[model samples]
Target: MTIPGGELFDNRDGEGRLRVGVLISGSGTNLQALIDACERHEINATVAVVVSNKHDAFGLERARKAGIPAVFVDRTAYTTISAYNHAIAEALDDHAVELVVMAGYMRLLGQEVLHAFPGRVMNLHPALLPAFPGASGIKEAFDYGAKVTGVTVHFADEHFDRGPVIAQEVVRIAEDDTVATLEAKIHAVEHGLIVEAVGLFADGRLEIDGRKVRVLPER
Candidate 1:
């Protein structure tokens, strides 16, 4: 649970707002949420960059439309996962990112990216983690007949969806709900929770200790 050399960034002086680099691999719903929050000034951070593993990801187009710097780091071009992650880390660093948010980023990040960002990287998972950790989380919950499922926003560790929990929002699964229905509800919660968590982070209201997250009172 211990993140190596975890030092929280200081935003008290307001020299500049937190700069966030978002990574996505799909439709980018959550990416859109963050961008909207930044535009509305609901969060004190800006989307400094957006990187995608796939060149044709719709998220890249979203970023470009927002006028944010977007990069495509293809994993197939790299010989190893570590190399690809190193390139991702370099891209984030190049933008002077203070935080990295993974929204529908399918690839499991390597140790290089984890070490490079330390406690700075965050990810949103469809299911309440430690329950369904891998892909197709909504389908997993539906197959298992779970009555209630939720969304989890957590730090990005070397493992998949195994990082410390930051925030979570629960959603009820009705008996009539199919996988798609459940996924839709999950996405709704994911968008709102991610925006809220990013605002808390930008305001320096989040304190991480081990696997626990403390939301301090706003200043």
Candidate 2:
């Protein structure tokens, strides 16, 4: 996996928090975790907005309930992927998004958004990336009978689930663990690891080095 070249300024919210835009396509469990972290002051950030490609995504509701602006740019409304992604980028920029987090966002973002945010875009994948990638990651890991699996947070590059890894936590596969159980464990780990990874990014604690992302010691 190649690391995209670029860097972001250390911008802060009015109170020194990071302003983030979360993109999602489903129930938004990870989105909820980030919101909870914000509310608890665990992460030095606030969600500026939440963008969903699916109009009916529960993430939009989650955002509204948290008093965060929620926008849905229906992918079907655009003829091309770049056009759709441009609208998403506009939505994020319009809200002054400093970081873009793919909580459960299913679509691979096009170059429009990738260029718009550069190193500021992050994605959470279900398996230890550079391993099982794509939508069927969890299933693939299970079928492969791996003893251990995990989640990864990485910068979003041009390819799918291929980027410099920011953070990861392992989940040991129990002998009795069914796919459902393994999935639950993976998600549980994701809830925490993703939050930690985003917090690190917001704090300027991450640096890209080829295929490696070094998380710097907190100052």
Candidate 3:
């Protein structure tokens, strides 16, 4: 997909690292993975800020411990979803965020935020998408008795888990594996795959063409 102005958008900071704003609603294991990746220089990016709809979310604590700005935008305070999303966009804008990572963020983002950072939002799903696309992906896949399920990192559109796929890694289910074991395997894959996808975005290697994402050669 072409960018808004038909030009590749580069929003890197002076340090040449992408400014990332991560949105989370839970414990933030994936967010921690990203923080670790940035700390180890595995990715050319930094966690500029973290936003959460719930004030009690542990992800906020994770961000605080990492010294990144953690913002709590209470959904109940806003009268409309648009107002809430605009508030979220405002928070990201305050940090000059170039990429938006939805790491277990429960609410769907509206156009107010999407228009602000077109083609720059990413999300992680527990199951390889086009199969189980919602919050119960792990349980759904396990109940369906699928032999293999995996993680998917993809660009986020207005719809739920229906954007361009960027990266995916399969995890085979062992006969003796319980749902808890399957979930553990999926989470493991999610941590690495999300980091890899973020790294690709930071390196300017991901190009969107229609509904598909292409990874360019390493620079």
Candidate 4:
């Protein structure tokens, strides 16, 4: 099943909620946040599954605790990067996932996987992207002594954190702030920013034009 280019996402799950698959590589605090939002009816979606590239990822435990399917896809199991991406996409497709969310999955997916989902992959970044675009965002921002930093949620293309932004929330950097303090603030905003972005997607309210994403008025 391949999504055609220029197609907007439609939440076609019969359950009346978008079927979402979350990808993670660590503790999955953001995954927990998504789970909480879904349980509280804060979003019109359900996490169909949680997949981790790391077998020891705590996010798998989080998924199991929530009675959700948890899977581990080891990168080394595949000989090629494209093959690995295809494997992950295959799992999401198996669950009939309508929305694919990268909640800290460390690997970059190639066109093989992105083509499967098309414009439906979502990602949350720990910083205001176009500024801090790598793994250690909080530390980089703090070490550089930036005044304001925040969270960004966006569509995921092949590029790393360079997709059209969906939402961003600013966090004021205090005069005497440590990396830990900045990280806490960034995560707090990430938990909500990602939920809001996914909520917009679940409602089929996002339109992507070139590199810009316009969130349409909620129906």
lDDT of each: 0.86, 0.88, 0.89, 0.86
Find the 10 residues in a row with the least total lDDT in model 1.
Answer: 4-13
Better of 3 and 4 by lDDT: 3
lDDT for residue 167 in candidate 4, whole number 0-100: 89
What TM-score number comes out for model 4? 0.93
lDDT of 3 at 128: 89
lDDT of 1 by residue, 1-219 (tens): 332221245532244677889999998999999999888888778899999999999999999999999899988899988889999999998988888899999999888887888788999999988888888888998899888889999988888899889898888899889888888899999999999988888777777887798887767
Evaluated at residue 161, the lDDT of candidate 2 is 96
Per-residue lDDT of model 2, residues 1-219, tens digit only: 222221344455667788889999999999999999999999878999999989999999999999999999987899988899999999999988888999989999989998998788999999998899999999899899998889999999899999788998888889999999998998999999988987887677888888888877766
Best by lDDT: 3
The alpha-carbon lDDT assigned to residue 69 of candidate 4 equals 96
Candidate 1's C-alpha lDDT? Answer: 0.86
Which segments of model 4 are wrong by more than 4 Å?
Answer: 1-14
User: RMSD of model 2, in Å?
Assistant: 2.8
Query: What is candidate 3's CA lDDT for residue 212?
Result: 80
- Model 2 segments more than 4 A misplaced: 1-11
Q: Looking at candidate 4, what is the lDDT of residue 63?
A: 99
Pairs that collide in candidate 2 are none
TM-score of 1: 0.92
The C-alpha RMSD of each candidate to the native structure, in angstroms, is: 2.9, 2.8, 2.2, 3.0
Task: Provide TM-scores for the models.
Answer: 0.92, 0.94, 0.95, 0.93
